[model samples]
Target: MTDSADSRASLGDGIRFAFGTLTVLPVRVARWDRAAARAGMLWAPLAGLVVGLFAAAVGGALALLDAGPLLAAVASAAVPAALTRGLHLDGLADTADGLGSGKPADDALRIMKQSDIGPFGVITVLFVLLAQIAALYELYGESWAQGALAAALSAVTARLALTLASRTGVPAARPGGLGAAVAQTVGMRTALTVAALVVAACAAAGTLFGASPVPSAAGAAHCALAAVAALAAAELLLRHCARRFGGVTGDVFGAVAETAATATLIALAVR
Candidate 1:
């Protein structure tokens, strides 16, 4: 039998591998580069779970304190914004500026890489955040579990899009960026695993804590629609990126995944 100390060490390594240290695991287990990148896509929902729980508590606290719902409203977004350190938000900005620059495609790509923000990029990030805040504010009143489900699945759906980003037409910009290594590592099986889990979550949420028949039905519909839309959006983007850069890159994956999640959540919440 393994010694107690060895067992404990194994546990610690497993925790680090799952939690924040994605690169520590063996490359053969899932491939170091792909595993880390997939973590970028897959773990959003896990991040959402943590953030959603906090948001749910914040909303409940607001209800108790009689501060009104809006404060808690913004607070929900605070968690995700903090978790990603606004990495996707940066992608959103760079993508917007690059697309809108009207410069040659190569110049636009270069601009996205430059560590500067432009008028378009700044506006893009703010407006995107504003839209997210509004959608989440509406969802604040929903059950904590439901809200949590939505947050986690939204992130997962975004990453599902990332699988498509790497696999579909997008050619990598260069040999190295975030895109190249992942393109080799990410595969159909990993993506399909994500897809299966997303579906399971949606079904389970509806069966478990749905408020009313109508709302439950609506929630189920929302999840289905969100998944379809996210996938479609990812596909469209990969096609564009393939044509534009001759291949996808890590930044492109970030941009596509963020856009898909935001759009999916907004679409589901609003209608």
Candidate 2:
């Protein structure tokens, strides 16, 4: 009983840490050890879930208010940035600049650490953000329900990338920072378990939302497919980053999340 209670407490800390680190949420994390960080990665998807719900709510409300899809798409796209202080977007930009430079590993890493965004970073962010808005606008035009479901699931799927990237076989790019701190902290078994749970939860949520008031099988499938596609995209990005950068870094994780989310949204918008 004592051991179970301790485990429960640690899990709680992990959840808190996940939210604290991933979002601009005001939740306080009581622990910051390796154990807590591992636990945090396991629960990171939940942070995405929160972000998704908020984005969905914003988009849904705009749709209800008869706002055009363009405005709704822009607002929904902005929600994650506002909530997370655009952290993932910043990572996406930095990673783009680094990778686009085609420099040696050390120079690429140095470029990524720089504060200024290069031409590659500028173009990447511009196109990526435009793609997200365009996709969400298309989705919203199809059905408000579809837009909401896609928004929520995309967020969750994107965050799932973090767990996969932190698995035991993945290494840190450098000696310190979030990459080193979380590198190899998640075992394969743990990552698979988390992935399974996330998929299940997303499916259930999609079904619930898809069926409310007006049911649409196509909408539900879109959500599920978006999740799967997002995961696949993240996995590909992770592998590429691992090879290109020597291993996964915190920036890599962010880039994966944003890219996955964008890809999912785009997939959902497809006919």
Candidate 3:
């Protein structure tokens, strides 16, 4: 095949891998090679964008139907969980349990692998969800556009965190499963490029939010800042998990994603 043809095939496989693994979308992954994993991590934000749009739509619809910001926030918060089949939340919970255990790396990994949620897991998940809902409520109260932008921004930010976590040099915690399949697959340069693009696009989108030019410019700045904050927060969690677990795992990826999403919402909620 020509180089162009190879590129097209690789791109297609990347989309499949991204949507198939990162989401509960119907896309069937056709390749599990490092090439595909690299492309998939690079494209993860696109999957997040789709999920964010769905969440925004649902929240906006609720607000339009005379539902209050609280309900709109609740609905928006639920959409990502529903779309991803709660996998990320479960990961956050498991990661909490592992970290809370404070055991050796092996024991912590074992705790994370267990299906049941422990006390620490339960409390952490509860607080995270509450924080997300509270942030969404504040944004929704400002305006429908504000709320919607936050919803979308957060989702994209979440996946962008995963992309960063998968970059080369981040080791996998185990020899098998999703972590091993994608860990250290993306280059640092590629991850940074994708992140910069996402932030630029989000800033452009935010400029459409407010009526006056000043507000619009502020909106753009806020959007950009929110992305930066989300990444910063997720990075902290990623580093902690890597050190604690001796490397990244599927649980770590999920935890990173949720942390980023929550941080985005919280940042946007601030006046």
- Once fitted onto the true fold, the runs of candidate 1 whose alpha carbons sit more than 4 angstroms away are 1-67, 141-148, 213-218
* Model 3: residues with Cα > 4 Å off, grouped in runs: 1-9, 211-215
Ranked by lDDT, top first: 3, 2, 1
Report the error of model 2 at residue 71, Å.
0.7
Model 2 lDDT tens row, 184-209: 87778778888888876766665644
Better of 2 and 3 by lDDT: 3
List lDDT for all candidates, in order.
Answer: 0.59, 0.83, 0.90
Query: Candidates' TM-scores?
Result: 0.74, 0.92, 0.95
TM-score of 1: 0.74
Model 3 quality (TM-score): 0.95
Worst 10 residues of 1 by lDDT: 1-10
lDDT of 3 by residue, 210-235 (tens): 66655488878888998999999999
Judge candidate 3 against the unseen true structure and give its global Cα lDDT, from 0 to 1.
0.90
lDDT for 57 in candidate 1 is: 62
